[model samples]
Target chain A: MTFARILQVFKKEMIELRRDKWARFRLVIPPIIQILVFGYAATFEVFGVSTAVLDLDHTQESRDLVSRFVYSDRFQIVKIARNQQEIVDGIDDSDAAIAIVIHPGFAQLLRKGQTAPVQVIVDGTNSNTALIALGYMNEIAATFSRDYMTDHLQRTRDGPPLRGALVTLEQRPWYNSGLNSRWFFVPGVIGTLVLTMIVNLTSFAIVREREVGTLEQIMVTPIQPVEFILGKTFPFFLIGLGEVVLIAGVGTLWFGIPFVGNPLVLLLGTSLFLLSTLAIGLLISTLCMTQQQAFATNFFVVNPLFTLSGFSFPITSMPTVLQWLSYLNPLRYYLVIIRATFLKGVGLSVLWPDMLALAAIGSTLLAVSILRFRKSLD
Target chain B: MSAPDKPKIRVAGLTKRFVGTTAVEGATFDIARGEIFGLVGPDGAGKTTVMRMLAGVMRPDAGSIEIDDVDVVADPEQAKLHLSYMPQRFGLYEDLTVDENIRFYADLFEVPRKLRDERTGPLLAASNMEAFRRRLAGQLSGGMKQKLGLICSLIHTPQVLLLDEPTTGVDPVSRRDFWRILYSLRESGVTILISTAYLDEAERCTRLALFHEGRLRYCDTPKRLKALMPGTLLAITSTAARDLHKALLGRDGVMSVMLVGDGVHAVVDDADRRVPELSAALDAGKIPHGELVRVTPSIEDLFVGLLKDEHAS
Candidate 1:
């Protein structure tokens, strides 16, 4: 309520911010790098996957099967291993992300008009990418089986089906036709960068004061608790908001991504999300005493939050429990809002529930931070 | 409480507890207007805890603090207007320049723009920081930083100033300069309460309160505290000062013998009477000796004796 005191606090924060070039850099660079790292490097479109094959049959049929996988552009045959031990060694050494085994009986079974099973193994450590790689492998194998069956049936006096020889499914992707990994990633990158920068920066503010023995200095003044918390939080709040704008602009103009949501609604969502993160950061500051502790704790919490934020994988396809867990994650909400606004063109009416949830989380976090901060000081 | 118009600050039965440990137990003290009172003790003696409670940064487990007759517990905000506290580290914003820090504090205390120019000039001059006004506080030396901290604490010009070891690591010259500023503030009728571990700094205070194990051992003027020494203190220097120190441990008329630096200082009862026996013992040991003049007991010596006496009882 004391505008003068709040203004004083605001001035103090800005002065401190302007002095440390690194902290300011951290505030900006973290988000920018996160946008690029998460946007470009992170993807569901698995390519150049190191795959090996054990082809026991040296017939044309077996060679044709191998050619099908090579032609799919998904897997690169890294090696043709001699036996299962070599395949196991390849997987263990991470030299290959997938392995396919074709038995010697494969060609003979095809000539005898019998189906033969081909075994495929994929590393499931990074389960999301592994799953995508598995899907690509299945598509290749299915096409090879269809081609062999059609050739064999013609020789057995069966003609092509009445519904034309074959029908190729035509895919038309809306908004992002190329499904550019950059387009899908940039918005989430913005969300994550803001999340880490705002949370880490604000989280250390109060703890740094405590470590340097300055909290007592500020507390002895006539400033109220709410005023102090808000004063310290606003600059970071604005920075987080600014980061979203900067990243969105960069993502759109430089990266060729589209922005279709109502600007006002988008800003409102971002503001709530940033407010939530700032509160969480402030709450962490109250719990930690030293700068190192604050840093460690922030990183520990942020790692999983970013991983499970639906930026890396689709939440809808995850197991029901994990999907439900995403409901409690603010990153999930923010990611949804960002992707919707930037890619889907959805507005307030469709996204009101997410906005409300963000607001609730932000308010709760702020209240909890203020309470803990007061208790710690007392 | 003393008389109705006794002092500008009064604390009665102030206690502070941390988890299972009691930091300050029933700490009672008073500081008159325009006086420099110090809480003298080593670390963990609850000096900082007491100051924090008085500053309203912390709440007491039990007791009352009154600043210029305002109840600190009932209304801490109003009470804060009458006091300014600089914590141990002085809380300098390293990134901000010297002048910016001062202005920031001034703004927090709501000093008007017109009055800000009038007050900041002398403060900066007193701190000898006028030339470095544009320099970041992080670039200042240890002493200048302390001076700037003092200036920042004084920006509001509160009636009472609470300092928690403002000169702990500062050099002697800067410590002296800091005390000079405090003296001027005292002359201007501000009540100053400071906590310090340095005995020499405690000697300059108008009054000193000795604290140990969360209890006050003694509180009086420096003169009166030295007068509280029940017997004479003699400085003893010899070739075998350590051996002689051990020999005088349980001897009659020997109050205490403590090693201070290279020499041992012995507190004896009637130094004139004990000198002959001390000499005879030295003769048996065949150790050359230096002067054994009777000297005033220092604040360190006084507190050590008090703690020993309390242990004996």
Candidate 2:
């Protein structure tokens, strides 16, 4: 456990990494590419949803209502349908994801001061996209109805004195006023990419030597198990830290996602998260005998760490059993820390508990790995 | 016995077992300081198991190992400070250059920079590998790889060196060069334990331990091992060598018969009488042959003879 021995190992690892072309490619190329792709692709907001407009009431009022969907910037009316058959054809052909239908008595019903119902039909092929598009349609229709009601009341000034001044609600969204999903996704990429690179690298560290028959060579030296493990994993820890900075800076500056929290808080949270993830890799390294076995085990291990961590799917939405399992996944806690830091601008006052959980998991995993590592050496 | 006073390596009742099989059972031996000890046997004879236990890379299931006053089983790390082991087919990092591999190992052993430079310079030159230092370890020939492995193990100048079949696949020329480097290391008083499949290599060791089927069948000098043969050996070279082999089996005065390359080697009670009798038999079979020549038993001849004896009883 001496520092000198550990530093020697650290130096060797760095030199090896510097020379390994694939390793260098993984460190530099993939993080940038992943951030570029995942930041934009992993979005909950769906725009340009092709819609078919079927306006039976071909009046100025019907035309004006159809314009609302177009102006929402979320839909494109690719087809002007004459009837239900045309709308059906558009949706069946996959040409339109949704259709806005106005009945023939739509304007007459509004003129009579009664309710006018607009039927919205959606394609459910990709349920997530369908669900998000449906939400956007609801918002657009609500705003149009509110405006039309106000205008109708002004034209009929004698209408029962209008109870309670027509109940107008003003909504204010905090932190992200326009609610950009990239603001949420870009910061999470920092955690995901760091987890992926550091875990995969560290997990293969000892196993590669074992497969190539160098581990026995190392074990025959005076280097202790703890010293070797620290030396092996610390280099990846530094790389993961550098990546967090690179991604956080890129997300905030390049992608225009705001970073409103204390950098020190973000740094602390990230280091703790890196500690646990690197320990997880070391544990995997001890359990595996070969690089291929390590890779297979990593597939099972990392896939769960990614999916179960509320990266794309919310843990609260999962079953109670899975939600409980997510508690053990360090990524779940790190996600809360990273998302809160990027979006909410909160610090340790809000994130101390998750930080503490990370410390506990990291230390426990590291201790176990060191114990198993020493045993495996013999 | 040539250790002068105290032995550098001692073992008592060393044993290791895998599930449903024993790898080494109650093995006991001592290696003196500065002795070039050979672990000799055919493949799967537990030679490697014995070498691994001595190197402290593996723990004996039921024995004690004391190396330089250190209990290797209970305290392998301490024992490691005194020994360097080159396992069978030692794998150097292919991506690293030869110099980088050496420097990396030197650092692990905490070799001082000045001392490392002094030693590495001559070691590479001695092995004629000084020019290849910058080359990646993967790019080197198999023999060069084994040489580099040996060099890396020696950077620490350990008290004991363990080499497991370092020349198993190397060319004869490289193997000669390899033995030269080992002889020099022995001159420096580094006690070495080398396990080899080639019986000729066993003759070069100051002492040899013959392992067979997980047991040490014989432990002594190569000279003494050949002295253990039951009778004089005769070499019968013939064109019909395979037939000559069958003809010599189960004959009186003949203790054992083995078909060697283009010849048959047999141990007999009396070489003179057996030669005449064997010549008569070969003549009856019309097997054209050369004159029967009496030769000293080689380590291989002795190993084959011992293995035959073990199978008999």
Q: Using DockQ, give the best candidate's number.
A: 1
Measured with C-alpha atoms, the lDDT of residue B14 in candidate 1 is 91
| RMSD for each of the candidates | 2.9, 3.7
Instruction: In model 1, state the lDDT of residue A65.
Output: 90
Candidate 1 collision pairs? none
Per-residue CA lDDT of candidate 1, range A1-378, in tens? 698788788878887787677876766665666666766676668888899989987788888998887776888999898898899999999998899988888899988988878888888897877889888878887778777887777667655642216768999998788988788888888888888888888988878888876676788878887898888889988888788888887788877789987788889999999878988898889889998999999999888788778887778788898888778778999888888888888998889999999998888888888898889887
Question: What lDDT score is found at residue B124 in candidate 2?
Answer: 95
Interface RMSD computed for candidate 2 is what? Answer: 1.3
Candidate 2's displacement at residue B242, Å, is: 6.8
lDDT, candidate 1, residue B236? 79
